[model samples]
Target chain A: MGVSVALVITMLELVGLFTFATSGALLAIQKGFDAVGILVLAILTALGGGILRDLIIGDTPPAAFTDVMYLVVPVVAAAVTFFAHPLLQRWTFTVLIFDAAGLGLFCVTGTLKALRFDLGPLQAVLLGVMTAVGGGVLRDITARETPALVQADSSLYAIPAALGSAGVVGAYHAGLPLGIVGTAAAVFVFGLRVVAMVRHWRAPRAWTRRRPEVGR
Target chain B: MGVSVALVITMLELVGLFTFATSGALLAIQKGFDAVGILVLAILTALGGGILRDLIIGDTPPAAFTDVMYLVVPVVAAAVTFFAHPLLQRWTFTVLIFDAAGLGLFCVTGTLKALRFDLGPLQAVLLGVMTAVGGGVLRDITARETPALVQADSSLYAIPAALGSAGVVGAYHAGLPLGIVGTAAAVFVFGLRVVAMVRHWRAPRAWTRRRPEVGR
Candidate 1:
């Protein structure tokens, strides 16, 4: 890992964190959660994925917890959304774009981290996709909603991430310059997500003859 | 640290995993999920908490993944529930008892693991409670239901685990024999959970003047 590459990854992570936090804060606002809830959701959405990634790779304390900058970014994003959400609420598309960027950035970075930890390419792809979607899952769970990732009617979310992660792993294994390949992969994922959202593309739901019902 | 203590803790963990898996499998049956869903939920519910704890403490590959018995217990539980669900469905109280037992055993074992990893007592207690309830939370989330831990109308769940974890931490700090004290704490938690269920005990929800609604 060159110094320049590390710096780039850090910048990408910061951007991803800020965007994810904003989305979480907006969702909290929409959910009628209080101010404290907004902050909690924001922080969780920002750091949850990275924390999960580090944990899987056996990193202690998690990088997000150790770095003050990572913590500060989400808090700042939450506070901004807290005061400015009324103005931001009209721009749902902007939020979707930001979320796509996060999905892209996290998948690449997460795959890199897993590979650095000596995980196989297959496992790396799994962890990378998890890193991209884990925070949103946590946020939805805390907000008492079914996570969109598993919702049959929801637009494609994890597929783009899996593709991005697989690309990164392939690039790494082929001895390609990761800094360039990683950035390209991230952009590819972001584009795919935006297209999926705009086109309302959905993953296939299970076909069942019987009506599904939840019983106590 | 002693061989006998290690064996005892392992036994508790296996018991906890089996019970949690059973609860998860039952939930899958209630949700009308397929056989694969039942197995996935059972494995996740049995191993999720322990894995979370291990990740926090930088334990790589997670004991549940590395040890064959840990994986085997959940598979067996899921198979039992899958074949015998018609009979098991009538015994809701039995399922609840198993869940309570899991809660008790996990709280004790989780705290002990955290303490061994040199986490502070407060942090250890938090991790312990998380370990006890984390599986249930994951299970509910996957089943597309609000986690019982945070649901306003749900019965007291995390509270007993917190109390048990606190007692375990206190006992550890006091240099008491951990095996005995830990067993006592687990028993105390189990009794508290069963009583709470029987009595319909609930943790208070936040009082709100405004109507609460989830908006998209």
Candidate 2:
């Protein structure tokens, strides 16, 4: 709750918002969607998970709906992505880094938020993962694609988020300071995600056709 | 709030739950999803909208999550659909009827719930439409299909839901008895949806390539 810690979380959130909105707008542009489509996807990507979480925690109107800045930031990000996409296309790696950072930041924050709302540690962890990945799942669904959260062959996503969520929830249960535990959890998630991406790590596939070991 | 009125809404809600769950299970079966997949979609399609509405209305834990019967009904429906989809496939018209019934029922119920939470007429009506159509959107998203809720070529899905929501909100605004207005609003939606289906009514497309007069 110190000023520096609060400042860092805020910065992470803003960066995450921008990256998620950019990704949403980029997807819309690729799909040849109109301006409205771009705006809708951008807003949903940036704030959908938080809205879902707030709603579950009995927060009416949602923070996004109330905070003009939160709403406007995503729109601004989307507009920039839409207009400067050609130049931004070359910055895919940077986008991925920022996206991973955002994922980590959100998972820890979400779990902490749930804990603050007096949810059980288990529910807190799960909701944390939901908050981290829900927006991307929604964005993919809107784009008519199999969401990465559920896809078996996709790179590490929900798993890393879940780990980060568990970390924060566990730390909270151990009576650790929120600022320190949150930072450590976020770092853990961000590091794992970035490494996984760099190594092209694929998660386990559940329904592989090559299950010859269980042959009839 | 009369016993009879409450009973009627309860009946409609149960019927809607069954139909939505069945539709969700059927979709999962069609998509070759496992039992878990069927159950997930069934539950989501039956309860996702109400959960969304409750979250929006600051109703924590959601009724579906808390009520044992609400959780069980969808599971039962999914199981039935899983085992009897072949037989149920022949009952397409029956499914349509139930789906339309659910659409009407949820809109009114959601709006009423929102009103109970002291929401304004606009939010109530919007939440009503969201409750009506949200399950199907989640269902389609899970199926990796473009949801009909926002598709241009799809029939009057959101339109009818919105109209039903508007009817209830308007009647309430006009100070009509809840029991009478609620029933009447549901009936109006059901009748319109059925007629639209039978007549093959298609809503107009927004982005047709043949905006011929706009250019050479």
Q: Estimate each model's TM-score.
A: 0.63, 0.60
Write candidate 2's Cα lDDT for B43-141 as tens digits.
Answer: 789998888898777679677645556767897998787677665534546666767887888898888888878889889889999998899888877
lDDT of every predicted structure (CA atoms): 0.84, 0.76
Query: How high is the lDDT of residue A123 in model 1?
Result: 69
Model 2 pairs whose backbones collide = none
Q: Compose the digit string of candidate 1's lDDT tens values, residues A88-192.
A: 646667667777888999999889888877777766886798788889879987897766665545677888898999999999899899999999999999999
Share of reference contacts found in each model = 0.24, 0.19
- The ten-residue window of minimal lDDT in model 1 chain A covers A203-212
How much does each candidate deviate at the interface, measured as C-alpha RMSD after superposition? Answer: 5.6, 8.4
Docking verdict class for candidate 2: incorrect
